[model samples]
Target: MAELNINGNRRMLIGKVVSDKADKTIVVLVETLVKHPLYKKYIRRRTKFMAHDPANDCKIGDKVQIVEFRPLSRRKRWHLDKILEKAV
Candidate 1:
């Protein structure tokens, strides 16, 4: 199985839940700030991750932590670790 690093530690990411309509699955929008190589200006980049949420505890707008894992589905390679902040 593909692992995050040589240390066998899974990669962790923080993101906000964008969708939770699927059963036991939640879509998270992880945003990162990247600096342009030539311009040196930071720009916002966003990626959507299909994460497994066995408990179905996440709701839209909730901030959560996800950990990389073995493939749970065709596009799901991450699992919800914790709900960092409840939707408010």
Candidate 2:
């Protein structure tokens, strides 16, 4: 038998950290696309995710990578993985 890795199927996203508050919660903005039904064109969309910041090192406008995890709070289901770029 093989062990099922449920938690290991985490999702990773690259975005910018928009906010850090409430002790260890951070907000990340991820930009993606949505296909237009009629025109068949892709539209850009921005999504905000509330994630757990265990180390609390992220800041506003800082590019970061986040991964999906078990809910840390009522809203937080993602965790900070690493900072890809710093805010200027």
Candidate 3:
């Protein structure tokens, strides 16, 4: 059998920190657009994700990047990778 080459699995998301609560968990809000099939009108949608911030460096209104990792808690399956940009 040939050895299988497994690629590392990670997820990256750019969003704004909606909340920073718990010990090291922050909520990120990701906005996206969906277009109607017939009308082609775009609709705005938002999703919230719980990400782990070990350093507690993220704050509300700050834009950041998050990556997937081993589950840190019941809802935290992602961790803060970096702060891409800060909110003005």
**Which candidate achieves the best TM-score against the true structure?**
1
Clashing pairs in 1: none
Error of 2 at 46 (Å): 1.5
Model 1, residue 63: what's the lDDT?
91
- Each prediction's RMSD over C-alphas, in Å, is 4.5, 6.6, 7.8
User: Could you estimate the TM-score for every candidate?
Assistant: 0.90, 0.84, 0.82
Model 3 weakest 10-residue run by lDDT:
1-10
Candidate 2 ranges with C-alpha deviation above 4 Å: 1-8
Candidate 2: clashing residue pairs, number: 0
State which candidate, 1 or 3, has the greater TM-score: 1
Distance from true location, Cα of 39 in model 2, Å = 0.8
* Candidate 1: count of backbone clashes, pairs at least 3 residues apart or interchain: 0
> Residue-wise lDDT of candidate 3 within 21-82, one digit each (tens)?
77788998877778989999988778888999888888889988887778777888878989
lDDT (Cα atoms) of all candidates against the true structure: 0.87, 0.80, 0.80
Regions more than 4 Å wrong, model 3: 1-8
**Alpha carbon lDDT of residue 24, candidate 1?**
97
Q: Write the per-residue lDDT of candidate 2 for residues 1-88, one digit (tens) a residue.
A: 1111244587788888878867888899888877999999988888888988878888899998888889777888988888888998
**What is the C-alpha lDDT profile of model 1 across 22-65, one tens digit per residue?**
99999999888889999999888889999999989899999988
